[model samples]
Target: MDNWEEVHEKWTSFQNLDPSLKKELDHLAGDKKKLEDAFYKELTFGTGGLRGVLGPGINRMNIYTVRKAVNGLAQYLKENTVNVYDRGVAISYDSRYMSQEFALETAKVLGAYGIRSYVFDELHPTPALSFAVRNLGTAAGVMITASHNPPEYNGFKVYNEDGGQITPAEASEIITFIQQTENELTVPYLERSELDNKELLNWIGEEIDNAYLEELAQISRLDDDGIKREKDLPIVFTPLHGTALELVTKGLRQLNFTNVDVVKEQAAPDPEFSTVDSPNPEEHQAFTMAIEEGKKSNADVLIGTDPDADRLGVAAKDDAGKYRVLTGNQLGSLLLDYILSHSDKAILTNGRLIKTIVTSELGRKIAAKYGVETIDTLTGFKFIGEKIRQFDATGETFVFGYEESYGYLISSFARDKDAVQAAILACEMAYYWNKQGKTLHDALHDLFEKHGFYLEGMSSLTLKGKEGSEKIAAIMESIRKEPLAEIAGLKVLEVEDYLSGERTFPENGSVEKIKLPNENVVKYKLDNDCWVCLRPSGTEPKIKCYFGVCSSSNQESVETLESLKTEMENVMNQV
Candidate 1:
């Protein structure tokens, strides 16, 4: 629909809706831009799942849209199940705007279909929700969080029985069902009170928290004795004002980390995330307060988690007496090395590591040294979680798993990324390293020397609104139509077009099938141990490009990265 027609339709529909929804619609009716933005299109739901600004509109995340999503999921479950309620669903939410309300709404919708739901009484981290699905033996799970997105945004992530995000094939089926529903308001739903009365909505809170914490505690490689000896090892932590506050602080106390400190300004959940422009831990702004606090406390390490506490970011004091934040790749490599180096040789003998192909290959090199097999999957923690499940079923040990975007999982107990668990492990790593009179920076440099120097960076081009989105699609099309045989001064050895499900070698004119499920991503491997990948953001209107380079020296690695980045920029500009 054209912009004006779409706006008019939404305005007319707003006048005809129920009183509550009509009130919300009226609030935006007078503003032409607001109306246009709200009615541009229905919110897109792909493999990364649903995300949008929370408001009342077809393009916004609101009660009607959420119910429509749940209705689709309900129908999918009913049609595919022999006993609908037997395969129940677990529901959890973070501290985002309307997150709790959305969680209850989801349960109510499930209850309307007579599908039982176990809903957390209060906000919980995303990883806990993933764990609950498997621990409670539910068929699926839903987490109401936007991860590190801005406060205006909210999202819904669907997970399968194995506690991983829904696979592409399953997500496509659900999306079909969602689109088939014409009137979102017509989707059935029960009131939260009514669902509770029917015993279809079960409130699960502290009991589950205790159980989850117990399992997390068991995964600790450090004992009370070790923690006691290193209790004074200074550590700083920040939750970025989302669900990890209580769990992470309590977990640290339980581990006997006496010198641990939480950033006071961001310790409480604030829906606005008032202190920072963006709550994403990967961005330096999110850690501004935490780093300042660390400097004052003279903390040896600084750690932060996003709003939902799924992804983790770390910073540490280098030998130069300056604080430096480590990329997800660097942190993952450190954790992988520490875990393997500290683990029993017997466990290491049968262990395996998993990471996304977009993640830095440094972890694989470390795993290789430990004799641990490394497996690569497509980007997304769900793929890593799926591999963990597969390994568990096949009796293969899962040593570690991570993605370069600050997501990591060490134990199978929590099926998704657990910043709480990561906080504990990071503190423990600091404690042991401190006892050895070394810092994380020193350890990182040592690893870099042992393995080849690996440097990686990411650039995202956000194309907001209708015009921007069309431009993004055009750029991807251009790249596909005119494939590059060389980037910078390096010859392209292979081009993996995930969307086409084929890998091509330009020099030899050879092509091979790609076994992974199809996705709209293209990766290029260069002869100089450098690689680049391009893929559009699933939940946002942005195109992301990833660059990875390896060299014998840090200077060479940085120079190569700079050259490739220039070339990639030129390609982007041309489009």
Candidate 2:
């Protein structure tokens, strides 16, 4: 078992498997590097569940790995529930390679365990899956999407009955089960028709779609005058060859936006995503075509979504008449300000805003102005979803939630982030601004002025393969061993070591407890309102360094951030 020959033997035992499965394995046969990469480890099922390159290997995403995950989940459900089949699981998929097949395979596996499953009839957005889980009173849910990754990648996101990603404690239990059931080849899967005949499989479609849309409509605060006055404001949208085209466009039209233009080339779901280099909406390149079309049509805004429509990206015309893509922080700030400013007075009485710890502080400032309380969670939309559920269970009002990574949620109906809702709101906000003789950029600048210049940036250091993994681990260890007393000419006031669950204030020589769960992250707070945080990405092979800086002037903030980024890079490289 030391060399790849043992691995090949283990792989060859599946020769009698499905043709597609065998073909994928055959393509990687006898290639040492490919074999090692595919078998180096099992695809991890953590708090975020599994994500990997889509192919045939134990370490890769394939039928066997998926079945193993489902088997573990099935066992967990059976042990936790009194009525296994009655507490069904909701399943949905996006427009990625073999996403439908994976979704079906998952459903079939759950059916073999005598678990009822409700699956979307066609490709749908991730948020819809989250919503369906809670709406149907299911025990769990699964979404088959990579969420802005390239076509070569696919992922499985697991959710609990509350419509939130599995918490760390729950994920630990599932991971233990998956590890105990090591022989994935022995996992059971019934035929699709067999499950259908047994009444264990349900296909959900427009009925749920309409219900979800109706709930979304309830959150719309657009007035008749505003809609009428700005109905003709030109806007361009691109789904980046994903699942949101029809739903987002339909939502826009339903809200009385008559001049919204869809990028025809990327309007349809294409697995290859031929038009863009990567399907991620965060990158400027993903919106190249849409921006061009917007310019040609003299549109006021250009918006794009990734394959699953959970995250949204927007570009607005600046005072210089040039289009500038707004970062996730900027977009969230604008949305928060707009929603709070325009919301009914009744909802604001007990309203609360939730954001991840890494998100910009500008959101908190805006929320303060409106008497809205803001809470910080760990860096994931799941944490936001968890907060929403907690509030609902306790009868507290949920107002808005967002992460720094282009994800936002407005309504509790969809527990996860909803780009469909964000798209509709963005358009309405644009309309509101248009009627005020201003643009989104102008509005953002005014907000920046009100709340001192709050700037944020993120840098990622990518390390691939097994060696790269070791290197990243070493870097984190080094940082922990040699603590920083100062960074970017500012004295480090405190260091929050999430892994140790302790916060140390050097100035006061005192320590405090952080109530959050333990994680492999560290944050340093400077004398000024600037901070730096470092953590390994949960789903990708990269170490992310996040920066937040505040100053009286925009130029000063930008310069300070650049200096901090340069210093951090230099320190990391030396390690």
Q: What number of clashing residue pairs does each candidate have, in the order they appear?
A: 0, 0
Candidate 2 TM-score, C-alpha based:
0.97
Residue pairs with clashing backbones, model 1: none
Q: Model 1 off-target regions past 4 Å?
A: 1-11, 14-21, 30-34, 227-230
Worst 10 residues of 2 by lDDT: 1-10
> Mind sharing the TM-score for model 1?
0.96
Model 1: lDDT of residue 209: 82
Winning model by lDDT: 2
Q: Give per-residue CA lDDT, model 1, range 325-349, as digits (tens).
A: 8899999999999999989989888
* Model 1 residue 157 lDDT score: 91
lDDT for each of the candidates? 0.86, 0.88
The residue-level lDDT of candidate 1 at 68 comes to 92
